[model samples]
Target chain A: MATGVTATAGTTRGRSRLRAALRVTAAVFGAYAFAWGIAAFGSALGALAGLAPAEAVTAASLLALLVLPVAALWAFAVPRAVMGWVLLGGGGALMTGVACAVRMALP
Target chain B: MSRVGGPNRGTPRKGKLISPALRAAMLWPHTWAGVTLGGLLMLVFFMGSLAVFAQEIDRWMMPATRVEAAGVPISLDHLSLDRAVRPVVERLAAGRAVRDWYVQLPEPRRPVMALRVRTDQGNAGGMATVDGTLLPPVGTLGASSFFYPLHYSLHLRAGFVGYWIVSFASVAMLVGLISGVIIHARIFKDFFTFRSWGQVRRSLLDLHNLTGVLVLPFHLMITVTGIVIILPIVLPAGVQTLYGGDIDRFYTDALGGYERPRTGIPAPLAPLDPMVAEARRLWGGGEPAVIFVHNAGDAASYVRINRDTGDRISLDVEPVYFDGVTGALLQHRRPGPMVATHRVLSGLHFAAFEHWPLRWLYFLFGLSGCVLIGTGMLHWMEKRRVAHGVRPGVGWRTVAAATCGTTTGLLIATLAMMLANRLLPAAVPSRELVEVAVFFLSWIGAGLHAGVRTVGNPPWSGQCTAVAGLAAACVLLNWITTGEHPVRALAGGDWAILGVDGVLALTALASWRVARRLAHRPMRMVAPTNAEVSDHA
Candidate 1:
């Protein structure tokens, strides 16, 4: 019985590995798009106010919260979409970088 | 030991079975190793996690101690070496029992001239004004700061015993983590798959394995770094052998050179302002946090400025020692690569340089590490239950009960301590004792509840309830004691206290939901009759 279970589990693993690869690729692409969107929005906010670079970046973080709902909706509508995972990962990274850069450059 | 090809070797009983000898050999070590040290590990991890925010917690707990005045650069012109040295030296000489004297100048957000006078009888240190007026001792119970010291050096036996115990636990944790990872080969596949409804035993095993795998990196890093943080203590024999047993020389070479000793004869000292100015200039404009003046009135009276820029984890600043009379730069200790690396590692482990975002990340990772350990313990219990063929024996049950009690119970106990800090009278003698009382009492309560309730229902639900209840108590206690509503505190820009309260509230809500789910879980009845077991087999 244990041997049969092991054999079945091995086959399932091989199938899942392929699926996981596809999922990862989608996650990465979605992350990039989300990060790019955030960076662009932050730059726009920096231009709008005469605030220091850091302040502008902080303001941009506030704006990024709005995209959370969109991300949530995306997660709901397409539960396993590679795009949603990517967006979350990429957006977080982008915002962190922008915030750090602004902090160093501004004051 | 049983021989190969023995009847018991290949036998498949109703439930998993091993010979008495095999069971004793395998189960005894596993059980004893876990049971003896599990409570200690939970304490270390939990306290260390809280210690990550020691400074912020200090700030929140002792609001009255908050330094309102910003530090001003000490002017070189106004510095009178004779003036500063005469007062401190005279005081020390009069006491005649003084071992060491440390003078600390003002810093931003904690502007107070501090002096530490070390005597044969422990050490006495407190804040003072620039003009040398000693302030009343601050009485607020610093929960975060208290936990910080307690974590690495369990507030017992002058920190030596604590260090050894913590070091041993760290090594054990590392072993457990590696062994656990190896045993569960399908680690990644089970990530994020927590099925709460299934065979109760199988579901628990799955949940434990999944959570452990997900947070394995955090557990590994924390365990390894915790050992590294105390590496000097654990590996002192090696250092002793290599450095010819000159611990002082080893420290100086490994860390930085200790300031040259002073001539006992009185002499003028250099003003601190120039030293502070030079430090700021070198560090590119950050506030000099601590000013250490050595050899107070002698020719060797040198001032070293430690800048607190809050930029990097490495607190290394150029040390400028001067001739007391001439104010000439004597020696500057710029750390080499090894020393700088050590400082950086210490800073990272302590989270001293973290801001809000990074601190939150540490908190999340710490919580995940806790969950990882917890799940691993639970999984071990489930596996034992399945293998034992009967309900686990008294010893196994005790360990299972303790695992639930200590991990989740300590969290609640910490919350209870925080609440005690506020409700207990500020003027209460031995306030620390009061805090400890609350901590232990809450822990004992959880332990008793776990021991009693575990027989009827799954232990996880009771553990969850304990955590939720404690967390809720913390939030409510804060409101009750401080009279600072969460919204009002947030509005007032007192986010440190507010954030802690809010996070505790969220933790309670989440745990409560988990508890509710676990409470409804159906109980399993294992067959007591040997005939029934044979039939199943």
Candidate 2:
């Protein structure tokens, strides 16, 4: 309801221009943090799953590298820039936490 | 809006799901990103496609290399390896250190045996026949060393700034591609949409979208893999953290974990035949392409034998090692999973380990990527061309000229380099430098021509005509200079030259067709009416 109201408050062009700028800014951070976090989480998960450390690190890094474009898509497709960033941060944190917990618990 | 609201009909009403506002929001970034970096991406894709045939281009450039390649069997008995290694030894003896030199033996892939010497003085070496007879200087840096570097380094004027620029453009392309998909209402259904004879801007937009979607996955993978390959230089944190900042150690680990130390003791180098025999024996069957003697003539000298690629999809050429003094084998272990994965990703980007069929496929897809960028740029410029009042503003005019310069100008520049290669005397000092100069100079000329050409009279068709003529001239000059034109090259079973010339002829024909289309377009750029404005919107 608030999104609809704020969206209607301003002129269409002005609101959209501001939103577009924010989207691009948020996306750059989302892409970087997501890329780094995914690699870390992947390696942790792989190590816990009994894969060789080198193999796990490599496979995880490579697969995570592919998520950059999709992450960009997610940034744009969301209803707002803040929501997109929140999702990126939340997902990255969860993955990193799970990966860390798995390493600590198993070892 | 003609083909909307079907696939996007999820959240109750169409407006609720993907509102008109959302579509416009996506379009803003998509258009800007795609337009701004489109030209550079076209260059990257175009040169990258050409680089796939780098070895083939080397053979075409140096016609003497056509008969023997690095892959074919050659008699090492008459190879006279000592004579080839003498110059580097002499250079080192003179006190100025010889940087690096290796015996690139004659094989079917790169037939001539090149001593490939590099000292502080520069390339003071030449190619040799199988019997060690000196072949004349090959003149031009094969498109591999010259034109192909443009793909990554773009001339090194600012020292690898080109690579970083390309990397950034690729990221923009990634973001733009994703936004394009989000904004697009019909993706799979509009896969085959190309209305060539329809209203001009509509036709171009449709064509751009079609090519963008057609090779979408390939473009994505290629862009991603390119970024991955450059990550070492771009984001060094991974290596810094992992290896504790020792790059050399990281390389050693990646290369199956072996590094030899040089001991200063005068010793005669062992004959390479025994090491070659041992490597062949160990590997079942494969010819050695490179015979690298490290710390040559030193007590700690070791020889590494690298196998040429054949019928494999890997960039990791497992090297076989041997003691240079004793000719006894010294083995290295296979690569770890991390290294192996890196090699595969790089191999996919380089596309080196493939036969001609796969190379052609990569080339075709790469050209399609160029088309996607070119068509997208045209769509944007076409709208601006019509929307303008009197003569259009400076911004629109600059973009108009830039569009022609990058598209047709790049073609002109590439062909001009090949022409310089043929015409420039090999004995002329810095012959390769002259050829590269011709390349950049011609590109500048094309840009100037496009900039001065009047509005409403686009410079495309004229520039394209020049491109066609220059391309045809390149084919002809090869015959005049080398006596190895496409017809005779084909007759002599020299497919390398044949393929190069054949592609040039086809490009000429295609350019001419483009020119003809541009020549026939009406004076005024077609104005999009209120009805069709929604199409772009």
Candidate 3:
């Protein structure tokens, strides 16, 4: 009985460690995706707001870069890493998708 | 682990972690990451600091690139662009299917007429006088070509590899900066405290903290901006998605690509003087720094005048266009507000518009960043030695040697490259390549020397002695080869050349003093091997 309990504990520990590793990996991808997606969306939004292509590109790109470090630090230090992915990664992808669609629709 | 004479300096008397356990976890990562990549950071910082003076170095390196009599700012007052450059255009047009020709109008900083011809075959170029008398090649790549790029690309093979390595180091730097702030408990206290004459370990830590904090804002800005500048290369996903892998197309769309299509029909080239005069009028007394003629000797040929941006913090690249034949004003694209903001950020990073005093301040801050990284490296080794109970392994020892070589070896390599430029035969085929070869070899040699000598304490004094010798050699080499010795330069009022030699002599003196001081300092106790333990007794 004791041996079986010990085996179960070991398995649980191993599984938890793997989950932690996966979460961290997700966080990495999320942080970068969020950073890139914001720049894309920002540029499109600027273009939509009647800015010149050059102006839009420059303004959006710089603003996005400023946000990147903050996003990176926050991703690593979040209470639950999954929440960071939901808020930043998912939101970023959605924003970029909408922006791309809007850009395509415009002249 | 007592405070007065603790065996391990890092060991706390109370041994309490800073408030939150999660925040405390950041400390270890910060220290280890900085240690692991500190050498690369040191190289970046050290090379970058020198690159601030790249233009001055260029002037020193090419002693023959004369502009005018001393104290007189050279201008293209007497020269007409069409009359003076007709022969150059005619000669170049004789070649097969030329695409573009770049004619750099003389500026006060670099008062020489330079032209580069881009043909269907490839690019070919030479320096020239206002009358198109071809000047001989300098045979040395100036700091603009070498150290400035080395600061960013590390002279690695041309590919994504160099970009990746630099970007990775930059990321490491970011982490180091962030974590360093947290781990440095009592940050304000560290800002005020520098225990230089105290225990060696304490002094090392204090110096590291002091320099790191002194230039914290600069360090942060340089790192963040560096990553952003190389963003497309590092993070290509956004660009790839938007432009379908066409970088040029993306730039065209974003930068308002103003390229005129080539008309194959040939025609006589028009005079550039009128166009330049018109451009100056448009710029309101500012001269055009560079003039570009697209589709040279063709009906479609157009002149683009890039405005001088020395006074403005922004690098104003928006050129005013003119019809080459009619000299009619074509297109002038004014930058928008966002574009203006982008210019400010990039301008701040490059500091091209900054004057001498600001440039000197940037140089000092950059050097402090180098010192900060160097101290961090030493502290890491010291910390490791105190924590571990055995002699440092081969890997650790190799790093120690590299730490010595990179700091001093880099200086020697740079000086050697310059010396080789003066000493090497200028007529030798690919003379530029030969000089570069000498530079790499000297750098590698320094790394090897450090690897061997840094067995216990790093041989700081010995490397400083080498530095002093090499620096002295630099001054001597310039005097022997250029015939414009520091003394002669001073007599002639050629401060540019004299400044380089003066700085070299001062550096040599500084190194000698450092060697003397380092030689007398007590060596730190390494994890005692049999030899070290016996020596200790």
lDDT per residue for candidate 1 within B119-196, as digits (tens), equals 555666666544544566555447544787678877665647888777666655654554455334455676666677
Give the DockQ of candidate 2. Answer: 0.22
The candidate with the higher DockQ, 1 or 3, is 3
Judged by DockQ cut-offs, is candidate 2 incorrect, acceptable, medium or high?
incorrect
TM-score-wise, the better of 2 and 3 is 3
- Compose the digit string of candidate 3's lDDT tens values, residues B1-537: 011111122333355544333344344335555666788888888878878788678777876665444466645576677777656755655666677888776655555666778888877666666557666887878887888888888878577687778877776677677767765767788789888887666688888888878789998987877776666556654454455556677565554446678688787667788888887877777667778888877888888888777777676666888887677888876667765665666667677773878878788888888888888888767655654444777766877787887888888788888888878887899988888898899989888888778777667898889889888888898888777788788888776677778888988999999999999977665553433222100
- lDDT-based ranking: 2, 3, 1
lDDT of 1 by residue, A1-107 (tens): 01122334666656544444433343333433453346344644463446432233333333432343234323212323355465566665665465445434532
Per TM-score, the best of the predicted structures is 3
Pairs in steric clash, model 1: A31-A86, A31-A87
Stretches of model 2 off by over 4 angstroms after superposition: A1-18, A40-57, A83-107, B1-26, B64-100, B118-125, B157-160, B386-390
Q: Report fnat for all candidates as fractions from 0 to 1.
A: 0.00, 0.16, 0.21
Q: What lDDT score is found at residue A105 in candidate 1?
A: 56
Highest-lDDT candidate: 2
Q: Name the weakest run of 10 consecutive residues (lDDT summed) in model 1 chain A.
A: A68-77
